[model samples]
Target: MDRITPRQALRMVVIAATALCFLMPLYWLTISALRPEADIFRFLNPFGPWTLIPNQLTADNIVGLWSGSFSRAIVNSIVVALVTVIAGLMVCASAAFALAVIEFPGRGVVFTTMIVSFLIPFDAIAVPLYSIMRGFNLQNSYAGLVLPGIGNGLAVFLLRQFFQGIPKELREAAMVDGMGWFRIFWSIYLPLSRPALVSAALIMFIFQWQAYLWPLLIAPSNDMKVAAVALAQFSSAYNVSFGLIFAGAAFLSLIPMLIFVFFQQYFTSSVAATGSKE
Candidate 1:
C-alpha cells in the first residue's frame, strides 16, 4: 500500500468536515428529540455535551405525538405520497418511454416544452391551480393534493435520457421477433428500465412525503393535514412543547430515512445511470 500523501490527508479532512457540517443538524435533532425539554433548553450550546450526550432520555414526547395528531397526519402523508409515487411513475415513465424510444413529429419541440415547464415554479401557478381545483370542488380532497403536482417534468427528462441510451439493437431484435410497439415496450424496455423507474419513484415518494405548501393550500382541513403541515401546527399550538415537536419530527424523518436506506442501492445506481451519457 502506498503511503498517505499530505495532499490526500488534507482532502480527506476537508471531506470529513463537510460531511459533519451536513450531519450536524440531524445529530442535533436526534439529540434534542431524545433528551428532556429542560436539558434541551437549559443547555444552549448546540454542539456541546447536551447534544452529544443527553443526560435525560425520554420517550413520552414521542408517544404523545403518536397518540395525538401525528398518527393521522402520517397516515394522510402516506396516502398522498404513495398515490403520487404510483401515478407519477406511470405518467412520467410512460411519457419518458414515448419521448425516448418512439419517434414522432414535433418530438423535439415537445421535449423542449416539457423540460421548460419545470422553470414555471408551482408558487407562480398556485392561484390558478387553486381556482381550477376549486372549480372542480377538489379542495381538501386527495385528488386535489395528488393531481396538480403529478406532472413531473424532471422525472420524464431523467427517465427519457436513460431510455434513449438503450441500444437500438434491442428494438430491432424485438421487431424481428414480431413484437409490436406496446408489446416491445412492455416486455423489454420496461423490464430493463427498472433502475431509472425506481429512482424516479423514490424521488417522487420523497417529494410528496415532504410536500408542505401545496398540501397545506389545497388540503388544509384537519382531516387532510400531512406530516409537514402537522409539524407547523405543533409549533403554532398555544402550548408549544419543543420536546414533543422534536420527537415527532425525528419519528416523521424515519420513513424517508428507512426508504433511502432500504433502496439506497437502487436510488444511487439509477441516479448515476440516468445522468450518464451514452
Candidate 2:
C-alpha cells in the first residue's frame, strides 16, 4: 500500500477528531454504566488514575431497568412505531400517487400547502392537538399515539417526488391495456419505488420511536408510556443513580441503531437517488 501524503494524513486526523467528538458522550455513558456507583464521582479527583476497576462491573442496573416498567415501555414503543410506519405509508403513498399521477384541479396548490405545513413546528400545535385528542377521548390510548404520526407532510412530499420520477410511458401503456389506476400503481409504481418506501419507513420509524414531548404530555401513565418517556422516571435532581440511568439510556439507543442497521442499504441508495435527481 502507498504511504499517505501530508494532505491525506491531515484529512485522516480531522476525521478522527470529528468521530471522537461525536463518540465521547456515548463512551462516557457506557463506561459510567459499567462503573460502580461510588466511582462515578471520581472525576472530582482529576489526578487519580482513570482506569475502570474490574469489580465495578455489575448487571444490577441493567436488570433493574428491565424489571421495572422499562420492558413494557420498550414494547409500547415498538408497537407505536410499527403502527405509525404502516399508517404513514398507506396514507402518504396514496396521496403521493394522486398528486403525481392525477390531473386534479388545485393539485399544485394542495401539494404546496402540504409542503408548507412541514415548516410548522410541533410546539406550535401542541395545545390545539391536545384539545382535539381530548374531544375524541383518544388521550392515553394507542390511537392517540398512532393518529398524529399518520399525517406527516414530509412523507407525502418524499413519496410524491419518487412517484413523479416513474416513466409516463408505463402508466400510459397500462391504461391502454384497460388496467385500472390502482392496479397500475400496485404493479408498476410501487415495485419500482421500494427504495423510497424503505427510506421513508426508516425515517418515520425513528421519529416515532424517539418522540418524547408529545408522548410525555399525552400518555403519562405506565400502561401508555413509551420508552423515551419511561426512561425519565428513573432519574431525579437529588436522587440520581448514574449507573442505572446510563444503562437504561444505552438500552434505548440500541433500538434505533438496530432499525437503521437493518435498512441501511435502502437508506443510502434512496438518499443517493434523491440527491442525483436534484
Candidate 3:
C-alpha cells in the first residue's frame, strides 16, 4: 500500500469536512421529515445528536402530501418537465444544427442574439409573458407552462457548440450521397450527439421542474400548480407546518439529485466537449 504524506492526509481531511458541511442541511431536512411533528423543532434550540437524528419517526408528513394537491402538483411538474425536455430538445437542437451546419445570412448575428438572451433575467419579462399567455387563452394550460421553456437559449448554445465540434466532412459526405438536411441531422448528427442531447434535456427539464413564478402567474389554480408552487402553499399566516415543508423539500430535492447522478457522465462529456470546441 502506498503511504500517505502528512500534507496529502490533511488535504483529504479538509475535503471530507467541506463535503460534510454541504451535506449537513440535506441530512437535517431528511431527518426532520421523518421526525414527529413536535420533535422536528424540539432538538434545534439546544442542538445535539437529536438534532441530526430522529428518535421517533413518523410517515404522516409523507402520507399527507399525497392526500392533497401536492400529489397533483408533482404530476403536473413531471408532465411539464418531460414535455419541456422533449419539445425543447427538438427546437433547440434544430436551431443549433442550423447555426452550426447550415449557411445563412446573419447566422453569426442570430447566434449572438441567442447567446445574449439567456443572460437576461426571466423575472424581467415574467409579467409581460403572463399577459401574452392570457391574451392567447393559454393561462392555466400546460401549453402556457411549457411554451417558454422550449426556446432555452443555453441549451441551444450548448448543442450548437457540440455540433460545431463534429467534422464538416461527415455532413458533406451525407449531402453528396443525396441525404436531405433533416435525414442527415436525424441519421448522423443526432446519433453522435447523445451527450449534448442529454445535457440539453437536463437543462430544459430543470427549467420546468424548478419553475415557481411562471407557474404561479400562469396557473394559479390548484389543478395546474407545480411542485414548487405547491410547496409554498404549505405555509400560512395562522400556522406553519415545518414537518410538511421539510418533507416536501426533501422529496423535491431528491429528484434533481437523482437525475444529475444518473446523467452526470453525459453532462460532463457535453460540458467538456462544448468548452473544448468553442
Instruction: Decide which is better by lDDT, 1 or 3.
Output: 3
Name the lDDT of candidate 2: 0.82
Q: How would you order the candidates by lDDT, starting with the best?
A: 3, 1, 2
What lDDT would each prediction earn against the true structure? 0.84, 0.82, 0.89
lDDT (tens digit, per residue) of candidate 1 on 183-253: 98888888988878887887778678767788878988988888899898889999998988898788777
After TM-score superposition, what is the CA distance of residue 256 in candidate 2 from its true location, in Å?
1.6
Per-candidate TM-scores read: 0.88, 0.86, 0.91
What root-mean-square deviation over C-alphas does model 2 reach?
3.2
Clashes of each: 0, 0, 0
Residue 223 miss distance in model 2 (angstroms): 1.1
Better of 1 and 2 by TM-score: 1
Give the alpha carbon lDDT tens digit for every residue of 118-227 in model 2: 88887578778988998999889999888888877888888999999999999999999999989988899889999779867876786787688889877888899998
Per-residue C-alpha lDDT of model 3 across residues 1-278, encoded as one tens digit per residue: 29999999999999999999999999899998888899987889897888887899899989977786688888988889988899899999999999999999999899999989999888689999899889999988999999999998999999999999999999999999999999989999999998889878988887888788899899989898888987887785256788778888899998898988888777677679799998
As a whole number from 0 to 100, the lDDT of residue 127 in candidate 3 is: 98
